[model samples]
Target chain A: MTSGITRRVRVLLWAARAGAADHSAVFTWKTWLFGWFVRMLAQVLFFATAGNLLGPGQARYLLVGNAVLMVALHGLFATASTTWELENGTLPLLVASPSSPSLVLTGRSLFWLPDGVACGLGAFLLLGPVVHLPIGLSAVALVTCLLVLVGLTTYALGLFLGSLVLTATDLRNVVSNAALVVMMALSGVEVPASAVGPVLGRIGAALPLTHGLLAIRRVLDGRGGGQVALLAAQEALVGACWLAAAVAVLTLRARRSRRDGAALFLT
Target chain B: MSLLAAAGRFQGQLVLTHRDYLIDLVRTPLLAAVFLLLVRHSGQPQLIAYGLVAPVLMAVWSMAMLISGEVVDSDRQLGTLELVIAAPVDFARLVVSRVWVTTTISLLTVVEVFAVSVLGFGITPEVDHPVVLVLGLLATAAATAGAAGLMAALFVATRTARTFQNTLSYPFLLLGGVFVPLDRLPAWTHPLGRLIYLSWSADLLRAALAPAPVAGAAWRICVILGLGLLAALVGRLVLGRVVRMVRETGTVGLR
Candidate 1:
């Protein structure tokens, strides 16, 4: 049992490293930096311009919201990389392996944590001069924690969605695109939750990014540390629940696939 | 069938059979709805109009761009690019036909957004000059197709064509003034924006939708059409050169 656990851990670590390398291999360091910087800047400018038209004192709101959203977006893309396995016809092997499929999925997403944090921090820092928000080091640190939680939650949610690709492989683009737009609309990414109507506001409350954004806003506005900590705790709890849900869903799906021999015929 | 007719029919068939292509049709309106949701709280009729129109323009541009942007690469991926190239047909005309069909399909997004804006949100944008608005949409479609052809020519031989295609979207949206007026951008970018046909198209669109007519409508329309012609000429030259290069190097389906 001890060796089995060790072997699983070793496999998980190997998969995480391989995933990270594959993700990074899509672009050179220079290309990645330039592409992401330009993309994030464009996104920030687009929303900030819209905020300008909306009303006064709203640019900052949009800047922070979109910056944090970059993290969740990264998480979504990271989890969606699982589709590559299906495309390459390796998904069934992963499912049929002695190691747990849930663990493998989690490992596949581990690298996104750092990638999300970097995007969040990079967006904040890059847009800081443009938007001119009053962010200090301590506040930055606090937002970093908030972004980490958001990343975990979004990654878990992405994993759940990615696992659904096992049955509907062609849904990869539709699901990711729809989820990004839906999350952006509902999670106060570019709009305040209160203004998004009661129904959407309730939905937003269930999303992990909403609480994290709320907490980051408070910290940026110089709120007390106690409230920030409470919000962070809530965000973490939401993320934990999503991770647990993803595990349950993946387990159930794996069992179904095995029982029906669907794993053998996955295209 | 003629190459143009065949290409158009092929593209239409692809759109019909490919679930992904059908899903692509829905992305724009969903994004438009998201934009609408973001600005719904503003309660300002003008802001609502701007939000609604921006997404429609983006949908038009994206669809036109993707038709050419993905055409060659997709053919290559499916191992049919060499066959298409080997056919004794005007390749540039084939590309143009494909883009034209895509542009026509993309126009549905404008109607979809209009319906959503009016029926879903109770915001009916005013079009003071319906004729000018229609003309503007036509010009925008032609210019976007030209630009897509130009990009398709440039991307056909490149390994990172898809990446470049995706990266061009936001920058074009910014420079095209899809979401904001040209004057709102940095002063230096104004000239750059004016160079893009989408900027002119957006100006014409905003003017048509505004309660009063804005000046320079005629000139903007002329410039947009002229740019479309220029892009078409340049794209034809580039596509011819790239095809020759690919034939010489025998890299039609490579990568």
Candidate 2:
């Protein structure tokens, strides 16, 4: 990008532009609404209706659980999109550049952040009445912010998975889809973490959506600040761990590529 | 029959080697796991039999919607639609065979769900009518393939087929009562739900697992087969018109 010091920042800006370009290529606004947004609505509707088997109370639980899952779903797409640079043949060029490749990879997925929040928020505001969520205006505002945290955290896990996909490119879809399934199962979307027993409960606690969801639930219940703050903090910590893992993996790959004259990404 | 077998063998190879087709392998069971989890957590673990069978049936329907739903659109995007039509092969049969293979793979969810239920939940699934269950499985697989073939024809008729695949997923899933029984669904949807082959398959499989004698199993099985045959026949006729429309409009290879 630029010269010696600020090259990282320059590459990040360039990566954002590239990500935006990719986004527009994939979706026109209308198709994005009809294609992606409508699917989210249908998915939430399916799960909420399935809750009818469990009665109305569980139906409400499912509506909230699945609607909040919209954020993690969109955000974890960063996992697949992270593999895009390599698929398009720009990955080698970035690896050969002076700026660290990790910088570019991390920054590009930022585009998914806001879209994810909107999905989470839209699902709630649209379907909440059917579930009859007792959400106040202030709570909606706060939950929107909490959804941003969920997006960032899930995207972090996605980036780590994406880094792994740099080598196993074919697993890109497999890995991302499997991860989505895991989030759906273990992330408090289907059943409470405690209900899944101790081992899975620990995993749900560590996963991205579990705490964020608890926080959202608390906000909707008009609970006090302490629970929300604690859960949010736990979510931020989980995200930080995943982000650190992603950075380490990327940095290691870059070092190995430099040592072997760019053999890592040649795959 | 040999032709169908050959076409199916070739398509199965592509599905194994290609990531696009193979991802369905993982997604089917994952969906089953979600159904099982819900069954357990919602205080009705006894309905584990329904939970186990539901996702397998749903997987067959999903294979129809997600894979067969886009078979034509995929060829259209690659400019292979006209070539595929002009070839010596029976295009409808080819599509049916390929989709049948995919739905067969989806049926493998039965094994996976059984393993998961036995292993994860310590609940061993029971089958009351072994003959009915076996016949139901074979019939369901056939009907799913036929449905997929029909979906392929319909998808090619519309411009938004690819995107429509995404939207088709859950709504059809809900309407078809893939998880819940049609009676459990709203009353108005019952007629429409009966039209889906999955509703029959789901009921058949659930009946086989229930502790009572399965009545009208033969009739239900026949209906599934009859619907499947009708779908395949209609798919062929509709596709003939689709080919003519594309050729006449001079957009055969373009869109």
Candidate 3:
């Protein structure tokens, strides 16, 4: 971390190392495959049924909804899985080995990138024929926006959740579920905010998910450039806030743990 | 008279179950309220219904899985599985007694959710077929129980029971006709869902609730019954194997 490499360079290195550590630590490919298959199948079934009810025109809507679900769930997964590592006493070694915690966390998030992409585009392609998504540059923009906004939002939230384990015990389900339910609900992943009413409508309006999802939808319609930049900017802002929150929590926990003799749990 | 006494004794084991149920109800009332409110306009808005049901199903499913995991892990932690196995209490009765407690909580949660939805959301399905609606609700609960039982067994048997609880059920919630209808799935994924108990539960619920007439009611019942039976059998078989494995090689932490 201190070999005079720039901070951005160090962060990338940490991210890659974190990804490697996670893959190596949790070497349950069989279980991963099983869980992945189950989720993919369930997602496919959901969209197929939704398409049946709304017709082809609404297929893109359902596809985007599913994409948001993937992002939200992945965020929870990455966050919880990382915290579980910390709680069980494996994260400290990586943290102390010249890599910043932030970089390592980012690296661990890379594993989900492929799956996230697949889930986002796979749902679209699988349901596109049924829904008649207009093929063009906008589709690319739609996928890109989803990858960045939804993806970044999830990563930041995951880090935030991971930070909670620093001072708390037995609050995993409560914290994880609350963060996920709010994110999913506010993001309008399950239903567009338009139908949920005024109070929730306002709340959703303030969140990044609504904008991120809307941006993706616009991209799907083949609109790009300035609009995409604006949407990305909104997502980046939300992501930055969440990222800051996660970092704050992690730093606080690290300081407290060191003072409390709980540093033994680190590495 | 002896049989009655025995049944009474069995019921007595479930005394703690009510407190458990009440505590959970208190904790999750907000979530339940929010869900029902969202679904008030489900009839006219398909997306709203999708949003409402996905989280509702997840909340309920998580409750069931968490309770079941608690049952299994506590037994494992306390090394009481062997004690319970050695006891002369009827094994079936033991399972039921424990399940009765969790199942009761789950049912009460469902009822509370429905009642709140009705009172708050003003959602009134045509009582033109109250019997069918009740039956549909019953089948849904049964299916949930079956899935819960199977999950319990799976977790009890596996080293990674905790992870399995989340990883396994996450998929079911997504495809259980909560967010999207079953018909939307590709033909290839249909067989996969049919293998999961949630598919059957969704089918039973949709048949009962969706503004469609019930056809082949007898067949639907059979399908529900078949799933419930299959789940019970599988759970038992898996538990047996897991117990054997645990006995032969001491259980260790999941990797």
Candidate 4:
């Protein structure tokens, strides 16, 4: 007798709790900060300094670009995490239930969102000045908002990919890692969209991280918040489309599997 | 040695058909793309050698040693560590054989990255000294296999082994001049590069690509061999100590 949206929200909230409980053992705060966070920062450093090898000016461009890439990584987390229900032998139960599985899937990896945002922001704040990136008060606030939007959009893309390959759960992580690697190459992360040429530029335009990275860079450029807002809105829109596609795929896959009453995705 | 060779060949055959393993190799080209494309965009085509060569060498480290380190971690997770520890075969030798398979397999990345550069980027990176290049590849494979011992020891030794392994991956790649050269890194980090065999191997391999005569190739190759031997010795000692402790504590069952 609860409203439909309300019930789904509750499922998401509870699923996020499960996810938090599950991953808490993987990395305590100390380990997460000193260990995982440091690793992400080092990755940013690796790319940024590599940029410096080309020319001094190229460093900050790469620093900002790779920093935002840390956000997209959370999206990849969503891919593997959504496949968890399939992993833990709960796919059949969740499919059998009247509740929507996509909601639960979304919530399961919600923990990665904050971690992604932290890595993105930490890369910016900690290493920004090393390359002489001007960090004013307004810049920080804008970049934070941009990071959140980018995280949500990329997470949506991840869910869609996860749903598409629910049965082949073993390849979920591979898909996520490969997709990220491809994105890092093709996305306007290290190179401008225009520079990748027309075909690749169009492909980059369609990816979640491309627009999000642009928004972050625009925010840093301080040309004004208007363009950044427009870019953020585009990122959010892309995310929404991915979210809708994810829901449709999840629903169709679940119903079809239930009808077949075979291949329960135990593996 | 024959047993090791046979074991390595068997694992290589199995991993060759493995979806996960093949996909791991597939990353080499994409990684190459990421590095080379950045150089292209930077308006410095001469620097392309670093981009072209780095991923191939990085594939050596990540594919051979990084994946090699995971052997123990995965065995532990699969509850096979106890069997491995108790097997009649020597544990270190078993691990060395597994690393042997991956090191040989890692060579395919050389072809993969080179093809990607020529076909994908239209840049042909030439090797001026094939003899030194071939010798460098052999020495690198040996050194990489040797380091796997250390990597495995770390995995068996600590609870934070995975994190440690993850942390070491890119830094090693960085030290190896994946996207940046060794000289470009901070002067203070120079000695640290000396500690990693990939650093010397990168210099040797890149020098082979240059048309100029490669000086001190023998010394560099010897240094790589020495470092590799040292790592293997240290790895065996640490692995023995850790296995003893794990057996004494009976905590192989625990993380």
| Reference-based TM-score of each model | 0.94, 0.91, 0.74, 0.94
Q: What digit string (tens of lDDT, one per residue) describes model 1 on residues A44-119?
A: 6778777777777678888888888878887777446766667767779977887777677668757777866887
Report the Cα lDDT for residue B244, model 4: 80
Candidate 2 chain A TM-score vs. reference chain A: 0.94
Q: How does residue A242 of candidate 1 score in lDDT?
A: 79
Off by over 4 Å in 3: A1-19, A24-34, A54-56, A90-115, A134-138, A197-199, A256-267, B1-74, B77-79, B82-93, B115-128, B154-167, B170-219, B241-255
List per-prediction Cα lDDT, in the order shown: 0.77, 0.81, 0.58, 0.81
RMSD of each: 2.1, 2.9, 5.7, 2.2
Q: Point out the worst 10-residue segment of candidate 2 chain B by lDDT.
A: B158-167
Candidate 1 CAPRI grade: medium
Model 3: TM-score for chain B: 0.74
lDDT of 3 by residue, B76-150 (tens): 565766766555664434554465456555556555556655675666434334566567556655655666667
Superposed model 2: Cα runs more than 4 Å off: A1-10, B70-86, B155-157, B244-252
Candidate 2 chain A lowest-lDDT run of ten: A1-10
**For model 3 chain A, where is the 10-residue window of minimal lDDT?**
A165-174
State the lDDT of candidate 2 residue by residue for B71-104, as single tens digits.
Answer: 7776776577788877888777778777877887
Residue B104 of model 4 has an lDDT of 84
- What DockQ, between 0 and 1, does each candidate earn? 0.60, 0.61, 0.26, 0.62
What tens digits encode model 2's per-residue C-alpha lDDT throughout A1-267? 356548667778888788988888877899879778887887887788778886558888888899888889877888888888877888888888777789899988788877788778888998888778767878888999899999999999999999988766778878888888888888889888877789978887888888999898888878949889999999999999999999999989888887888645653
What CAPRI class is candidate 3?
acceptable
